[model samples]
Target: MSKSKSKRVSIPRSEAEMPSHVYSQLNTSFRSQDVEGDTNLPPVIRSKLQDLFAQIEKEFENLYNENLNLHDKIDALNEKLEKENYNPERQQTIFESTDDVIPVKTSKHKLSGSSQKLKTAHKLKAQTSKIVSSFKTPSVVCSVVKELRGHRDGVWDVAVARPGVPLVGTASADHTALIWIMESGKCALRYIGHSGSVNSIRFHPTRDLVLTASGDQTAHVWQAAITPDYNKTGASSDEDIEGGGEGESGCDTDIEGGGGTSTLRTPIAELTGHAGVVSHADWMSGGDLIITASWDRTAGLYDVEKKELVNTLTGHDQEITHVCGHHSQRLIVTSSQDTTFRLWDFREPIHSVSVFQGHTDTVTSAIFTKREEKVISGSDDRTVKVWDLRNMRSPQATIRSDSAINKLAVSNLGIIAIPHDNRQVRLFDLTGQRIARHRQGHQRMVCSVAWADEHSFSSNFFSCGFDRLILGWSIQNIKDL
Candidate 1:
């Protein structure tokens, strides 16, 4: 129509691969830019341009940050390498020249080694101190002096034959007694023929005879030495007259003077008066009189030389267990199962000076201290009570034992040896302080203990229950300087 306005009409390609109108449309859009302001564009194109610009900005920022971090890393690496190559002498020189501070690494080995050596030296010094302390304390050294074994059964008692002689007499439960030579430790003679076990034995004070108490209800006296048979023509009254009427032959005179028969034989004397078992017998300190206790609740004083029962002291109501004479006084103390011990004046029949009490059970054994002013009694109540002779109502000291004390002996040095059912032989000073404990040998219930000397002593302690072995222990003081 109006050759028509000949207006150029452009269409945007929508689906066509090749379209002449697409190029015409881009030229038209550029020429018509004034159609919208320069800032105004299609929504889709504006958004796409904004996203692309944001991505480019982000990439530039990332590159700039990476370059800065690389510079810092290189600088740190170079500083560390410089420090590694630095010389301590150069650093000291720099510090001295400029008064600058320099860091230094300590010599760890030298300092640590010295500290370790100091600790080791301190430990060694402590160990040496402990050893020295132990060495400074008192210690005991013991040795077996002699061993005597001859009884068919356990030996119940042993006594020294004389003050310094190496001879001893032992009574056994085998119904026999033996005389032992301590030096050789051999049985010199066997005194047999007792009807029951021999419970106690003692040597005559000045003679070669031994006295033994047996369960047979009799006490026998025997010559310790063996004897030979001898003719009794001159000694017998009947044969003496037959030889006295005529001149006595030379052979008879030789027999009488030479004593060719048996000088070793001594007359055997049997003391019989108690109605019960004799528990113990002992010679007086003077060695002239003998005292004995019996289960019949009676104690007797006998003139050993005259073979006569001098006095029968009777007051206890139970078995008398022990008896001992005073060392300096004429008093005698006897203990019994009746839970009491009595002090008797042997010089006078009616003198019962004191009666000791406070034991809860049977008094098993008692002994007068060497001073004779005090008495110590061991009881089945597991206690050892010390009583002053002046006042016997209360005990001066009471020592508790782990078990019943079967026997007690005081050494001349004022030490007490106590044997009990616990199998230990304990030694205590007169002050009742425990000084030492010795195993009479492992686990044996030690029943008897005796002291053989003053400061140094030996014990004849026997065990019955487990070990059933008789043992001897020798102990002596180790003084501290």
Candidate 2:
């Protein structure tokens, strides 16, 4: 072999780069003379190359599947972030914008049919213009104000004084009733005589007297000087009047030495009789009779002139929460934690004239409106309902609120004030249209709301769970009555 060494034929660099097995197979399939001259590769070598291509194809498929799975994971994370970003305090807007798309064509040769092309372009332009014009803008307007703080220990009740007077009364679990002045934005006075938490306070229709119901099982009358018109001199010049002949001598003498202007600060009387806590009390239209509801499941009528409890009305199976005398003085309405509202005839010593039983939760407050022919009630079921006195079997209208409604007051201008647990004071017209919403900064829950006049309103809204702060709001507007 050394004598005539057969030099190994060198393969081209491109074929030499393959595996030695592939090169060996290629070499075995063809003669050296034929491989040098032939343009096509051997069948065996081609088969090996095909197997390598299939392996690469499978690897690419696996990589593509992994990329798709990563994409799905990213999409899931993005959706979760979007939901977290949504804020309930912000107003939601639902509107879309439409912008027409136009296509442009560029060619070396111009169109031979100019009329057809021009007509098509004009049609497209018209369609785009129409779409742009039809696009709508958001038309809804939302109030920028939000709820402030609410009470913590639970707001028992609220009342507003007469117009132009910046005073509001709030009863609370703190065992006191606070008088707030809007002008000074400070608590003007605290009526602190009740041994327990005060449940309610109501301003007299004409006088500066305020009546408060307390858990101490008693009601107190507070006299605050609203104006100088109140008699302070205590001088009786009409001693021999018509109805006041000889018996008036004692009455005149009693009124003569009552005091000067300080008499207005003295409580007119303290009415007591309820076996349980007095939840609510109110003065009648004439300011002569006071109606009070108690947790003993009974409501009582007090004769202010006689300074004695007149009648005891008992029917409710649970605690009585509220009571109101009719504007005509012929009837009375009451609400209870037993989920019922009853209409009573004060003159007839019989049964209730009608019974309202639609509320699914405890009725906490009730008021007679429309000259005492209709009644409005607020309940823990988060609803405010209006009912006709004639048909108390069902409610005529039910307005749903965001939270439990504790108090309802119908303003003289036909606006209804609803104080809710969301620390909001809402104003609704008789038709259930929300006209205004005020954010109260109470830290706990808003217990009550009342209107002093058409142009003024006050809330005895406070929170004990917060900082034991009481707040009052006064709003002014130029809208027609």
Candidate 3:
């Protein structure tokens, strides 16, 4: 037992850094005592000392191994830094803030229905991947293409039309949604129905509809005045489709259009059932169904045409902070303040198909990758974890961040955009290797970001934040310099 206890004690690596003479003296003294074991020492005490020395030797071995591992980590980090061309000045930026600082709002409520009983089996599978010993920070170039400023308050979410239509929608704390023409940066339409802050926004996968989730505990679906073919042809201007001439400056504080026949603000449907704030909402690829997560600790499945709630997903112990549904599969994933994310087969929204717990703090955002086989999440703990839907036991990989990751966006190319509280946006590959970072992109916390299309290598994306500005970023490949 004494020997086992001694073995459990680890040697301090600091001792190895001491002068060589000190270590030699200690070793020689111990050896000399062993030679004189025949004299003066009590037998029991001698046995205990021998056990202690054996334990020390074992601990030394462990210390040596640990030192090697640490050195490897250091070398990997150095290589990554060099590859990214890392500079302290580039990672940080000067800020100029006004009164538009947007404070984070948190809310909570109980699940609406506990009247029914449900049963589900818990199962887990194992997964494997290449061990990424360190973060792979890649080099990138970012250029600001447009700066849209129309919202009176901070902007919380931005969603660009998929592929063809060069249109962007922004949700703001000003209690309105603005649809902008990307090329001209003109606000095409301003939706003014939400009674509270618009927390999230999304464009329909195959239609001219835009969905906005608000702190008013409702989700509004608005019809955009663009032709279906324009949504598939990557049109540059709305003048040909809408027959509206140039209206205002791209950075003008004034919106472009007035109440006219061309502009529409009335929503097709207003789905309201949550008892608390609705933080996130998304449309399936079919554009027929909508999914939402709310502070009521429940996820609701709604029929877009019927404009009514079809089912309620309840099981989370805390507020459902964010939700994303698969574009191709019948699955949906949600993040919660309970520091856990749950994956549910939307066909059966009554019970969670799987529960993923790894985040140490509130899980602020989660999204399904293009393949619908994996889910990635960001948390207040300043880390992003990726999980395989098949293997629900442990995360496949964990990407560390310098600050809390407030939002995460994944493109079809397997690239991930992480908006952080430190006023920076970072992009990474599916393998957890950081490929690029945009430091000068925002003057305040980057509240949200979204890709313009499904192109794997598309250079253009949109971002908006507490700075009350909508930004378009175009990525460029760097020439050898």
Candidate 4:
């Protein structure tokens, strides 16, 4: 038998050990040099050149195999981590709350009726084009001014107190609510009466009281004070906090750190009657009554003084997601997962119900803009519809987004502050023109957003997310040309 030739095995060169000059030589133009197959080369030199090309091809194959091995190891590590942290039950609950998002682009409706009264469609197009053309750069610039932290779980809602007190209240899933000093980032007081998560909170329109809705099927009115007595007492006992028990009508919170004597630890009253979880509650423009939306598919009208549910407005076919009181009217609107929202006149309750049906999925939030003239509704379908109260037949305009919306706040200038599930906060003009897109600072889905003081030159807003952090954002107005 003929002697077998010894097999040659090539080893991969480490990236650092690879010859640097070889890369430069390979990158050189082949047209300027004699190729390996050229007949002008001597036979010995030609044979050597072929060997050099073979070596380069072997090195390339080695590098490619090494890269693929690294990728396979990384993928295995990621899969292991995912398996270690998986929770199917919690995943199902979240899916039920916001509905699974297929991640699409869609939203609609007009700000009001007049924007739709365009004599010609071309005029509307021209106006939109002018707005777009004028914005050569981002008109609004916002960044996280502060990151407030304290709660053990995600913050669901945040509300700013009147200017003088300089207080910010936040509700959380940690079975507690915190009142933080806006300037110092210190937790002043804590509320812990609810047996379940505190879902929403709103500061009293004219007093130092906060109304908090919870998953425990109850809403509690408590003192929201910023005095020295309650300062840094976030560790106060739960019994000491809810000392007044259920319904004992206390006093207003003295936010100025003055000598006013009022009990700040106990809850004032607990509004009870919801069969399911009370998602949210809001104070009417007049501040005498409070309206609540519950998972029971109805909204409750409560008298603030009596601390009792007076009427239950019913029409939706699914759980009510959010409720909002008209800015200056006795009307209230409730959004639900039934894909429709109903406008209710508290004066007549059941008799004066108007159903606005258009959203194809759950209506996440609905709010009145322009002094109850226009209603803006955000849905899980990734669309926000603007309905003119004057013409309820169709939408005034429509705004589309990439993610499902949670709760949205609108500035006095008709700009919508929309918080999304994709960890983005977007601002849109009433005409559906995107004003700004803020995508930083939150590690999880952004839950709720609130406007600071609208009268200031630089409009400021706050956003909270499932990352258990509250971020304060400010947008400096683009100076006029």
Candidate 5:
């Protein structure tokens, strides 16, 4: 009786009334001053309390605005679905050819011995065999043949060496650029010269030189040597060479350990003119000049031989994200954080020839098709837009994705590989038809994807991401279509 004398019953509140407890606590804190002898709080304490109340009010306002935005997004998505007449329950795959049609499987045990029946049975068997063969001998859409693991930090970019070189270069957040033997996936050489993370790296179009852009506000051109220098102790496959320090073995300029090939950390040429971090650098078709994009809201064209800045393309209102030289045309495409992509003529770097402005957010990446007739760009708005250079006033097509895209790679076989923030690498045809999608291909955001070579459309490409993994994927044609 004594133990149960004064038990306080607790009642659970409904979902709508859950905030009553919080309101009670706030009321108690404010009413305490009224109950106390000193009804007025100290000026400092009162000011602090007012600031806290203001912060809470601002937070609630932000949450309300966010809810409104989300509701509008949902409505927009519903409108798009209605416009497209998309019916998930009755999804159909459109086939371009009759060869993709296959008959339903049925029991053959109940068939009669009539000649016509036997002929029909033979035809069915042949069709089944052909389909099974196709399944067994499927073309490589994507296969992870190798996993290059040397960078201790996230790899920001990767570049495959020219055909027959069997080498690949990687720019890493660990403040170094590395070369790997493509065949063995071994760290063949390491270039350590940047004071900050290497943002982008590229092999000279036709030379043995590699150009690397760094967050240190500089780009370096390094000499890549394929000769095996066994006399010098090479760095271990997993070791990272310090950018400017001597090795533990007292080697001031070279890495302590060398791989099959050697990459001197001492840069042959340092292109340092940008006031902000350089994000991207690419060589012109002939490798005679280089184009770079920087956070300083400018893109610069530099003479490779003269090692001097030629012209700075200065029209972007925000940071320039990426720069790419056209394969055949003299045009250069530059993507920017201002939600637009600009095409600048290298011959006339002072002005942009055409500006594409449809993306709602930052334009993170852009690339030119093989012949430079079209440009494909990916934006933080989760859309891939194709713009015909001939008509730059409007986009030719818009391909929507579930997540924001980081990079895009176009193959010669009309396949486009887009790595997105959702950790998916999707393949689409030039017409925007989704060919394939590798969901959760990496554990984290995929930063970049590149076709291994011109002949790589048969099923070879490389991808690197924030997961610290470099994966090789092969593309396979759909078999059960």
Candidate 6:
């Protein structure tokens, strides 16, 4: 046991670095005094004790220096933690004094039977569940299926082609948009028409066209071949279609390897009337009209065929951030930075307008459900409110979050995916109950989320972030909720 204890003891630096020496005098003297071993043993032990004192001093010095280094690291970490406190008010403006901030007004009417049931169920489930956020799912754990990394700057938005077409498009601050082949994670086509940051992209509901909104104060409608690799003509051509006048047109006949894509260098239509950056663009259900929300504090309705602005929807006090077309109707909703969102009936050409004021801060994103009976709006105030279209005075239910929401997407299966500034993307049902969390694939603020189709393991929902990566997450089992 004594030998074992000695073996476990650490060697001191002084002993390790001690000068090499041979005790030749002691060897000669000990040889001569072999018969008087007892008499010389005391002298040898005393010499060894003297050597140990020096080593102990050096070891204590090393221990002191190590302690000092540890203290320095602790001080640095504490300083950083104080600077990056969880409360966002310290790092950025909370907009608390924006006196125009309006409280949700009280409505005299009661909720319908379905809404009442939704609110009750959400409240009960939340109360029964633990307060801490858990990442574990009961059946399937969400994971990153693939990481798409081609953008040189932050990716702003992502949209998938209609189900069964393995194509995904992303907008970036590098002044370009890329079409990614989802199966192989390769960039298939590069659209380089926008002169400024491309903020949003969406495919036509039924055409082979893709629309992009840009910070250059314009939105472009470009042709994108539906084939797997965009090799329709089999040769590079400079052929310009009739309406592709604003940008240049060129094509690469042979696709390159190592995640490279052919370039579609032109846009077929340029919708250009906004005074500021066009923030978002989407095609209406009929595919004949396009609506765009812009930082100019107005929404523009454009005729796709004529490539002209038809009417401007007004009434927001700040920049509009997002716009979504109704699933089956001629109506559209526009979310704005003015802490409100407005609904417009395109059937009346912007004459029939109603504003919904519920969020306390900028409304970052808003979209209608599949049935058009409700709208979910996310805001900078860290809350998502579900509003019944028939009653805009108050929200049917509110899903409060700890961080600001950047964007949200409601899937065809009625599941909502909301991406937050805290690098987490959470899924919630329309009733406001959180079903699952996807914390696997992002390292920075997640800016956008999109669904390829219904909730299926084969059909991935995507998210892009300020980390310059797009992560496709598999979350089919979330439907178990």
- What would the per-residue lDDT of candidate 3 be over residues 79-169, giving only the tens digit for each residue? 5544354332332221112112323442322221211111111110011112121333346677787788788776878888876667788
Note each model's CA RMSD in angstroms: 47.7, 33.1, 26.2, 25.0, 16.7, 24.0
Q: What is the lDDT of residue 230 in candidate 4?
A: 41
Pick the winner on lDDT between candidates 3 and 5: 3
Model 3 regions more than 4 Å off: 1-137, 227-253, 256-264, 347-352, 453-459, 478-481
What overall lDDT goes with each candidate model?
A: 0.57, 0.57, 0.68, 0.68, 0.67, 0.70
* Highest-TM-score candidate: 6
The clash count for each model shown is 0, 16, 1, 12, 14, 0
Candidate 6: list runs displaced more than 4 Å: 1-140, 229-260, 348-350, 455-459
lDDT of 4 by residue, 210-304 (tens): 88888788888887655654432322234454323222233213222212212344577889998988888898886788999888888898998
In terms of lDDT, the best-performing candidate is 6
- When 5 and 6 are scored with TM-score, the better candidate is 6
Model 5 lowest lDDT segment of ten: 18-27
Q: Score candidate 2 by lDDT.
A: 0.57
Report the C-alpha lDDT of model 2 over 358-417, residue by residue, as the tens digit: 788778778877444678888877788877766767777667664567667886655667
- How accurate locally is residue 361 in candidate 2, as Cα lDDT from 0 to 100? 79
**Which one wins by TM-score: 1 or 5?**
5
Compared with the true structure, the alpha-carbon lDDT of candidate 1 equals 0.57
**In lDDT terms, how accurate is model 5?**
0.67
TM-score of each: 0.58, 0.57, 0.66, 0.66, 0.66, 0.68
lDDT of 6 by residue, 341-425 (tens): 8888867633688888888888888898885588999987789988888888889878877567877898776788898765678
Candidate 3 lDDT at 255 equals: 52
